[model samples]
Target: MPEANIADRFDLTNWKTESLRMTAFLSPGSPIPQQNWWEEICGSPPEVRSSQPRTGVQQDEGLFGDGNTQGRLILAVQPSRIDWLLTVEVVPTSFELPSVGSFSESANSFAQLMNRWLDVSPNLQRIAFGANLLLPFEDVEQAYQSLPAYFPLNKLDLKNAQDFNYRINRPRNVDYDISDLKINRLSTWSVMTFTAFQFTNVGSYTYSSAPLNVAIRLELDINTSIDFSGELSKDELPKMFAQLVEYAKEIALKGDIL
Candidate 1:
């Protein structure tokens, strides 16, 4: 493809600006469950009874699957507890640049940076590298601006994921089902948006969220229930955001689209 196509399609210049919103939720009470925790299955829980579905599969079977799938092992917040859900949602809004190719390339670069960040998070370290990789998502407000010819965008959406259920219980996660893949004229820049909801592992926390819900659920089964009722400080949000902005700037400047 032409250089203009490549640059517009893969560039991420606008997202590096300091206008997007990002947030993180931390849970500190759920206890990590080990193999010994499930000594007594006792059938299933109430959530299973009330879960909505129209397929032919049983609820437990659908949720837990056949049990032989790789990464499909059961997770108990505690040796004997499965009562609450904890979830953390980090929403980052990025802007695409003039070249669709560059925008797409920048989207990929942004995803890569998040992958590297996961590698450093002490809580997410145990999970396989690149197993449940992050993906760029467009915010609802940006749906209209995501048109193919728009070229650049005011904001791009994305998510950080962990212990994906389909991967954990279904042997492998080889499907790319999320729609809205915008590849520029030269096929260099590509952007996609989607959502995920489930109870899962994060560091020592067990978080849960529904695509339709507003507040993410967080669960910790630690010996002592975690309490953050004003025990923490939050004056560093700006500094952290500034650092991420620099990271994005560096990536856009490098202009590598492989």
Candidate 2:
């Protein structure tokens, strides 16, 4: 095993440039649309939507989870075929174990199991174009980094939304859902709002602070702290939202969120 690089929180550079980023163009023989049939056969989970508020803005939250997720799963898909874009870091060797202890030896076993599941499972890959499963920096350091056994689905949790310092808090409001609204009034804008979801393991055992079955709603009265005097496109907002919704649908059904 190699030593851990504390400077690089997650070894994402090599994996993204080398293996995770790919373009799977649709082909006549691509198995993209049969995802629904596969889901019916295997009974994979479905994707669900929630709302998050930030800086008086509300954005939709796309849910991604393991089969037993508290919320629904979101998928990424295309019409004729589906595609996956994975950005994950390689595990580092000589990683420290969590509170429970080191389970390094179990890494290969889990990988093998997931691979077999994908190969034989009828419902898993049906809706995906291709999937991007990233290994954490710590996991790559040692063969089987015993994080999942103690953490269960913690590995799949997206780190951006959980960490406050991370980009996930770009919008900086608890009730803003990006999928539903567009901040189009600023003609000479200097600052743009960004919202991202982050997560990570801490000194203690990591668990879902919020349940899988969770929803947050926010109401905007259409009164003026800001003026709606600027022209609203009326069309572009929904168009972009529809695209996002569809992508979420594809990921949840295909089991590609990993």
Question: Quick one: best TM-score, which candidate?
Answer: 2
Residue-wise lDDT of candidate 1 within 33-140, one digit each (tens)? Answer: 222212233234423322223421122211222221111122223222222111111233322211112222333433343333333222210111111112133343
TM-scores, all models, native as reference: 0.19, 0.21
Q: Which residue ranges in model 2 land beyond 4 Å of their true spot?
A: 1-24, 28-34, 37-42, 45-73, 84-258
lDDT of each: 0.25, 0.23
The local distance difference test score of model 1 is 0.25
Question: Positional deviation of 169 in candidate 1, in angstroms?
Answer: 25
Error of 2 at 59 (Å): 18
Instruction: Judge candidate 1 at residue 176 and give its lDDT.
Output: 20
Superposition TM-score, candidate 1 onto the true structure: 0.19
TM-score of 2: 0.21
